[model samples]
Target: MYCPPAFREEELPALHDLMRAVRLANVVTSGTSGLHASPLPLFLDETDGPYGALYGHLARANEQWKDTPTGEALAIFMGSDAYVTPSWYASKKEHGKVVPTWNYTVVQARGPIEFFEDEGRLRGVVERLTSLHEAGRPEIWSVSDAPEKFIKGQLRGIVGLRLAITSLEGKRKMSQNRSAADRAGVAAGLSASARPGERLAAAEIPQG
Candidate 1:
C-alpha cells in the first residue's frame, strides 16, 4: 500500500484490531501460471508468531491452492471507508484547492503460505473460524451441531491454509492530513450521512 506518513498505522495491536474487525480478506498469490486471488474468511492467531499467523480454508476445486506460490502470499483486509467530498473541507472555500478523496482503513499481511488436507487440522480450523464469527449470535452454531459424517464429507471438499505472517502493514487514511478545522468539517459531514459506512468512518477521524 502507498501510505503517507500521516496515514500509516505501525502499531501492532492497532493493526491486529483492524484485521480482527474485518471478517473477509483477499488472499493473493503468484504462481507459474500467473497471479490468483481468493476472498477468504481468515482467522488470525495472534500468539502464533511475532506478526501472527492466519488460517482459512479454500475450496478443493480452487486452482489457486494447487499451484506453488513463488514467494510470500498477501492477505488484504479492508475496513470502513467513505467518499470525502471537497465540499466538506473548510479550506475548499478559502482557496478552492482541495479535491475529493477517500477515507478508509486497511491491513496487508504477507507470509509464507502452506496448504494442508489433514482432516483433523481442517476440522480444527473450521471450528475456530466458526466460533470467531458466531460469538455474539443468539444461537451459536458449532461444528458438532452438524452430523459428524456430514461434516467429515464437507471437510473433504475443502483444504486448509496457514500463513505465518512475515510482514504486516496497516493504513488508516482518516483525514489525518487535513487541518483541524477541515477534519472537523469532514467528521460533521460524514456523521450526518445516511450511509452506515460513512457514519462509522466519521468516528474514526482524529479529533486533534
Candidate 2:
C-alpha cells in the first residue's frame, strides 16, 4: 500500500479492528505457476502471535492451496470506502485545484501460510469462524446443529489455512490530507449521502 504519512495507520489495535470488522479478505500467494487469489472469510486470533494469526478455509478443489507459495501470503481486508467529489472541497471554490479522490480504510497482513487437512483442526476453524459472524443473530447456527456424519463429509471437501502474521500495514485515507474546512465539507457531504458506505465513511474522517 502506497500510504502517505498523514494517512498511515500503524497502531496494532487499530489494524486488528479493521481486520475484524471486515469479514472477507483477499488471500493472495505467488507460486511457480503464477499468482493466485481467493476471497475468503477469515477470522483473526489476536493472541496467536505477536502480530496475530488468521484462520480460514479454502475449497479442496481450489488450486491455490496445492501450489508451493514462493513467499509470504498476503491477506487484504477492506473497510468503509466512499467517493469524494471535488465539489465537496472548499479548496475547489478557492483555487479550483482540488480533484476527486477516494476515501477508504484497508489493512494488509503478510505471513507464512500453512494449509492443513486435519479434521479436528478444520472443524475448530469452521466453528470459530461461524461463531464470529453469527454472534448477534436472532438464531445462531452451529456445526453441531448438523448431523456429525454430514458435517464430517462437508469438512472433507475443504482445507483449513493458518497465516501467522509477520507484519501488518494499515491505511485510512479519510481526507486527512485535506484542509480542516475541506475535511468538514467532505464529512458533511458523505453523511448526507444515501449510500450506506458513504455514511459509514463519514464517521472515519478526523474532525481535527
Candidate 3:
C-alpha cells in the first residue's frame, strides 16, 4: 500500500464503501510458515470498531487459521482496475516520456486476526454475508433455506474469522498524477475501449 499523496484516499466513509463494494478480500498473515494468504468474501461490521471489524470464514482445515500470526494481518480489497496505456497520455506524444501504468481503487485493513469455531458466531457471519451478496436477486438465498442439520454439518467444516481492524488505508489511482490534457486523453481513450474495467476507470478520472 505505497500511497503517494496524489493517490492516497484517507476518508473513512469512502474506504468503507470501497471495501464493501468489493466483496472478496485477500487476507494475508505471516506465521511460522512464513506467509499465507487466503481469498475470502469478508463483511465489514462498521459499528464494531472505529476502523470497523471484519468477518469471514475459512475451511476448517486451512492451516492459515491454525497458525498464530506473527504480527498484524492485512486484508486487501480491490475495486475497478485497468491498464493505462502510454497511447492514452498526451505526454507520450509531447516528450515520449510517459510509460504504461495502472489505475485502480484499493483498501487495506490491518488488524489482529482471530479464528473461532463458535457455531452461533459462525452462523451469524454466514447468514449476514449471504444476505449482503444475494440482495436484489430474483430469488435470494438464506442460511435457513438449507436443512438445519445440513447447515450445521456445513458449518462444521468451516472456521469463523473476526478481525478488529486497527488501521484502514485506501488508495485511488485514477490518472490524478497526469496533466489536465493527459487525463482528458486517458478518459476519452478508456471510454472508447471495449473493456468494462477501462470504461469504469474512464469515468473515475477527473474531467475539466
lDDT winner: 1
Q: What are the runs in model 1 whose C-alpha is more than 4 Å off? A: none
Alpha-carbon error at 47 in model 3, in Å? 0.5
Instruction: Estimate the TM-score for candidate 3.
Output: 0.95
User: Which has the higher lDDT value, candidate number 1 or candidate number 3?
Assistant: 1
State each model's CA lDDT, in order.
0.95, 0.94, 0.91
lDDT of 3 at 21: 86
Model 3 lDDT tens row, 90-206:
888889998899999999999998988999989999999999999999998998889999999999999999988999999999989889999999899989989887898789898
Question: What ranges in model 3 sit over 4 Å off?
Answer: 69-71
TM-score of each: 0.97, 0.97, 0.95
Residue-level lDDT tens digits of model 2 in 1-74: 89999889999999999999997899999887889999999999999999999999999999999994646999
> For model 1, how does the per-residue alpha-carbon lDDT over 61-140 read when each residue is reduced to its tens digit?
99999986646999999999999999989998899999999999999999999999999999999999999999999999
Q: Clashing pairs in model 3?
A: none
- The local lDDT score (0 to 100) that residue 96 gets in candidate 3 is 99
